[model samples]
Target chain A: MNIKEISEDRLVIFKDKNTLTIKEHEKLISLMQQIEESMMPILNVNVSYNAVTVQWDIFKMDVNDVKENIQTLIKNLDHIKIETLEKKIVEIPVCYDSEFGIDQDKFDMPIEELIELHTKNEYRVYMLGFLPGFMYLGGLDKRLYKERLDTPRKKIDKGSVGIAGGQTGVYPQNAPGGWNIIGRTPIEMVKEGIPIVRPGNYVKFNSITIDEYRRLNNDKNN
Target chain B: MIRIIKPGMYSSIQDLGRTGVEKFGQSESGAMNFRAMMLSNKMLDNPLSNPVIEMTIVGPEFEVLKDITIAVFGTEKIRLNGSIVSTASFIELKEGDHVKVGRLLDTRGYIAVDGRMNSNHILGSQSVHSQLLDIHPLRKGDVIKIDGANEASLEKKIMSKYPTVKTYKGKPVIRVMIGEDAERVKNLDSFFKESYTIQSDSNRMAIKLSGTKIEADEYDIVSDVTRLGLIQVTKDGNPMVLMNDRQTTGGYLRLGTVAKVDLPILADARLESLVYFEEISIEDARALYNEEMERIQGTYYLP
Candidate 1:
């Protein structure tokens, strides 16, 4: 683990590996909490797979002092008494009908087998981005992995479920995307600022018939 | 209440932003130009956090329903009841009065009423994020409710100091700081010595630029992290300056943040405008930011 200064003195970049485990994510969050408790005017902390960028008010604390404290904390990671984070599981219903799934035929496997493989595994919400309420989930089954489209779609409907590379996630809003779409969820505005499915939360997708989808969809949006 | 006779290019409600929701992948959706918004609110005796109508490209043609003072900010040819009006200053408006704004010189403008806008708030902000609020920009016939008093008081108008963009040889010179991958950037000379032109596709999300390539040692870093005013060097080596509606996180290597003081300048730059990012020390950036906060807080006092 190492701490690198970004953009002069405001943001500190912490990089570990190309990808981080859930525990590493938890550690970074806890470290940020410790810094906040120290009365540092930390504005925001952003974490990718292996990097955590800490944005702060440069005037509040000496940049060098903040860097030193972060280094010391990382060196003594084992001694840090950080509590475990709360885990949440969110259930998502996806409709994989022929009309909604534009690239369904791209997969050679039967739709049922594909759906079965998807539902059996749980995905971890590593981060949410690209669009509001959009989460990038990890833990896709190796057998169901697929590449993105050569030319991206002009507009992908909201609540569209997709798979790209080694990741599987759902789109919260309609926008241009190259991911391979397999289904669409009836949930409109899946999660707003309230953040129903936040980072570190586990997501489970359940397949439903068009009737059930319409029923949930007709319930005036999820 | 106000009625939109013409939607203009784009008009939506926004405040400072919805903070403390990055954990849920929320971007701080706010005014593209904070300085202009702050100044507009201050001049009109309005709360700084009150939601204002953010207009883009072509300004909207609207009518105020009550006797209230309104302020327009940023670079745009605006008229109140067919009369040319100055920006950063409050102009009295009356019932059924027509207010029209023309095409923007900077591609963005702002309209701040003397009070708050009655709109649904999600995540503790009146800001309208498409995903959060599920609403689009203002259109013709849309009614916006404001909380200003019924009677106009011209005495409430106050004056303050604000700076416009400085163009050195016809290019908007933007001051920036170093980014997270500052040490890894191998082409620092090209970044500073060479000027970049803003792309036309630039919007609230980011202002894309194409110029001298400043590729960092690493590009496939991480996804999903805080990036505001970050100048990200994409895999193709183009610089994209993230704005208020930027993603919560990204994977590209960022050069640094554009000083908040200069954000309004960047926002006012016209499409395809040439912009430069001159790096500055963090200490100077802090001092300037503090000065801006002070300027916005109590820019002027009215008797």
Candidate 2:
């Protein structure tokens, strides 16, 4: 892994052979904070293990000053090591009923097998986008990779778990969608009142029967 | 107070935008043209960051419920009681007076009310992200309440000099900084030098450029935080410049980010206009952005 400064205030950490571990990510965050504190008139720093981009507010300081601070920060990062934090295994209950999974029929595998394949792997949250609380989770089974619908549905119901390419995610709101729907999660990924899963949070799906889902839904209401 | 007799096309409340929430997959949904929005607010003697009504290509029609002062800016031709008014001018509206924004030569327009809009702030922003936030667009029959001094000896005045709205003419040369994944872009020089047309499929989220396509070394790149003015090369090698309402993260290989100052040019670009890329240092980009901001704020005059 090599960290190179692309522009005066921009930096990119290249990860070629080595996959970016959680520890490396943490170290990058701490290093960013340290540089931000020492440097006057805040700098915007963004870090991704695979190919992260960092942009700084060069308006406040001179170009040379920002470059010097970034160079120093990169040099000092060698000593800092990120300590792994405890990983939480969240059990998200999902229903793979045919009606809810509108696009699931397109897949060759049966519903039960699809659910099994989805739940088998611990998915990592690569990034969040498109809508609030929408997690783009990687590490899906390659066999489950499927193309998006030819014509996207006008509205994909909220909490509808879908797959596109090799990624799987849940819709936070009822918006236009093109992903292949595989299941529906009872848990709301994005709550209007409060946020559920943020970026960098690991998620695991636990298959549940319709009966269990009904009981849990009723329990929450009660 | 103003009553929406007819909200032409898409109209919504917008401000500077919500930042620091991009990490949560939240877009920085604000006015597409910050300069226009700020100028409109400035003309009204209102705070630059105050929430204003953003009118699309086809502007909105409003009936003044009460006598108040307002200012209009951007591309649309303004009309008061069916008579055309000059752009970038402040006008006093009397009760029962109807104002219609004519068809826009450009894609967007701004109308800054004298005071703050009566709306709840979500995620520290008043700007409406209708698609994700599930907020309804401003429509006909909707009455929007505003706060400000009543029409007491309000004199209609227009500034003698106004900042010229800069636009990209002919083949636009968009300056950009090389992306972190510049290595992924095969035939990098050809990607920049060749002319690309702004595809009709472009929108606030992304502008798809059509022309000669360049292949990327990798197909599926990990999604990460994307910013405005980012030229993301899609799977088919076409470049899509991400805008204000763009997804917080994406998987496409980024070519580079267009200078912030030049973003408005891209936003207001006519469909099928040819665009070319020019590389600039990060220092030059920041300096130019600051210079433009200063000029808009009247700190410095453009000769």
Estimated TM-score per prediction?
A: 0.85, 0.84
Encode model 1's per-residue lDDT on A73-114: one tens digit a residue.
776665866567666778989999978888888888899988
Per-candidate Cα lDDT values, in order, are 0.75, 0.73
Best by TM-score: 1
Predicted structure 1: lDDT:
0.75
**Proportion of native contacts in model 2?**
0.47
- Among these predictions, the greatest DockQ belongs to 1
Give a tens-digit lDDT track for model 1, residues B10-95. 78888998766665567878898887777777776677777888988888898888666677875534787888876645777789
Interface RMSD of each: 2.9, 3.5
The residue-by-residue lDDT of candidate 2 on A48-130, one tens digit each, is 43544555555567656655765677678775554454665556788887767888778887878888899998876655566
Among all windows of 10 consecutive residues in model 1 chain A, the one with the lowest summed lDDT is A5-14
